[model samples]
Target: MPIYKTIAHNSQTSVKIWKITESYEDLLKPLDLKPKNLTRVLGMKSELHQRGFLSIRHLLREFGYTDQDLFYDGNGKPHLKDGKHISITHSFTFSAVVVSEDFVGIDIEKQRDKIAVIAHKFVDYELDYLNKIAENYVNDLTKIWCVKESLYKMFATNGLSFKEHCLVIPFAKKEESTVAWIDYKDKKFRYNAQFLEFEGFTCAYTLPS
Candidate 1:
C-alpha cells in the first residue's frame, strides 16, 4: 500500500508509516539488502513478519536511506550512519519508522480487548484515570502501551519499568498530544507525546522535551 502516512512533527523530526499489503516476494524483489538483513528476514518464521521487515526498508528508502545506512546497537536500538536517531515498529499489517535529529520514538498497535487483560503488566499510574468498563478502555490502554513502548525505544535503556518508572499525564481521548515523564534511578527525563487512531489501530510517538 506504499506509504500510508508521513508526519513532519517539527523541523528536526519526521515519521513515516507503511501499510504492508504486498507479498513477501513482491517486497523482496525490488530492493538491495545487506546480507545480514537478508539472513534476518529468511530466518523469520512468518511471511507477515518478513513483509513487515522488508516494508521498513522501503520506508527507509523514502528518506534516502538503505539497509547499509542503518545498524543496531548492543541493546538493539537502531541508529543511522548519518547520526540520526531511528525507531522502527511493525504490528499486524502496519510498519512505521521515525527519524529525528533529537531522540525520538514511535509505536503502532492494533486495538484489541486482549490488551485489557494484560494492562496490569505495564500500567500503573495510568490506572488512576482509566475506566475499565467504558468504551474508551481499549483505546486508552493501547495508547498508554504505545506511549511506554515509544519511550522504551527512545531511552533504549535496560531496567526501565513501565509500571514503576513511567508516568503518562492525564489526557482525554480526543487530544492530539500530552506530557509524560520517566523517573528512574534519580535521573528524570520528560517527553512530549502525540497520538492518532485510524482503522482500529492506535499509534503514538514521543519527542524529548
Candidate 2:
C-alpha cells in the first residue's frame, strides 16, 4: 500500500504524505534511483526509512528545491534558504511533511491503547477535560497524543513535559479542530490544530499565529 496525499493549503503552503508498504526498491524507482546507489547514499537502517527520506526529497523537488535548499538552524529547526518553514514526521509506516511561509508543525501517531496509561506523564490540565467525556474512544486518545506531539515539535525544547507545560482545550469525539497552548521557558505560545485520520493513524498539524 503506497498511500500518497497532498494538500495545497494555499499558494504559500502545502503538505504531502507517503504511506509505505511496497518494497523499498519499487518506491525508489519513482525517485529515479537504484537500490544499490540509494543504500550507499542514505545508509539508513532499513529500506523503508530510506524510502521515507527519499519521499521528502522528492517533495522538495516538486517545489523546485533540493537537499541543499534545506539546513538546520542552531536550535535544530529545519529551515529553507527561501525562509519557508518545514516540518517532517515519520511513524512505523508513514511519513509526512508540511511546508509553509510561516512556522508550522506536524505529527503522526499510530493508534494504541498504551497511550492512555502514559497519559498522565504528558497530560495534566487536559485530564480534567478528557475525563468529562461520557465515553472513551481510542480515536480520542490518539487525537490527544497527536496534538501533544505537534506541540512538542513546535516548541522543540528540553524540559517541557507534556503533562506539565502543554495544555489542550476540551473537544468532543470526532472533533476536527482544537486549541492548544504550551508554556516553555516562561513563554507561552498558542496554536489552532486540525486532525486527520489516515489508515488507523492520527495526524495533526499546527500553525502558530
Candidate 3:
C-alpha cells in the first residue's frame, strides 16, 4: 500500500492519505470488502472512483480497521463500529480518511480555477474578506470549500445550506488553523478547522474542541 501522508493529530486523531498508483485489479485483490461494498465498487462507472473507493479501504487498514468495521448512516456519513468519529474523502488520484475520538470531518480537493466559477454557490459571509484578484484566489476558494464540506460531513444534518449554514473564518494561507461555525435549526456549533496544501491538492479537516 502506498500511504502518501499521515498526520498523528494529538495521539487520538489520525489523518491518512493514500496516493492511488496501483491498478484497479491490484487494489481489488487485497481488499476485504463486504458483499455490499464489493457490488458498489464494481458498479462504479469511473475507474478513478473505483480506485479511490478501494484506496479508502487501504486507509482503513492503516488504522487497524477493515470494511466490516465501517457503516454508513441514512445521510451517507460513515461511522466506525468502535464509535470513533470518521470522515473520508477522495479526489482524482488521492483518497483520505480522518479518524478522531471527537466528532470530526475531512475533505480533499484538487486546486482548480473552476472552483472560482462556482464560488458563489457555497461562499457568502466570507466573501467580504476574499481578494478575487490575488494569486491565491483559487487556493482561498478551494480551502473555504473544503472547510464547509468538512463541516457538512461532521454536522451530517440534512438540508444544511453551505452558503447559509456554514461559515469559515478568514485566514491567510500561512495559517494552518482557523475557526468555522454551523448555524442550523435552533443551535450553533463551532469547530477548529485545520488545512494543508500538498501535491497540488488541498485537504481540510474539522474537530470540535
Top lDDT: which candidate number?
3
lDDT of 1: 0.92
Report lDDT (Cα) of residue 67, candidate 3.
Answer: 98
**Selected candidate, larger lDDT, 1 vs 2:** 1
What tens digits encode model 3's per-residue C-alpha lDDT throughout 72-184? 99999999999999999999998999999999999999999999999999999999999999999999999999999999999998899999999999997699889999988
- Give the per-residue Cα lDDT of candidate 1 at 61: 96
Q: Summarize candidate 2's per-residue lDDT along 1-209 as a digit string, tens digits.
A: 43378877778778788776656666566664445545554677776667667766666666667766777776676778988889878777788888988778888888877777777677678767665344555677778778888777777777778777887888877678889888777888888887888788888888775
Mind sharing the TM-score for model 3? 0.98
Residue pairs in collision within model 3: none
User: Could you tell me every candidate's TM-score relative to the true structure?
Assistant: 0.98, 0.83, 0.98
Residue 63, model 2: lDDT of: 69
Reference-based lDDT, residue 191, model 1: 99
For candidate 3, the lDDT comes to 0.94
- Compared with the true structure, model 2 gives a TM-score of 0.83
| Candidate numbers, best lDDT first, in rank order | 3, 1, 2
List the candidates ranked by TM-score, beginning with the highest.
1, 3, 2
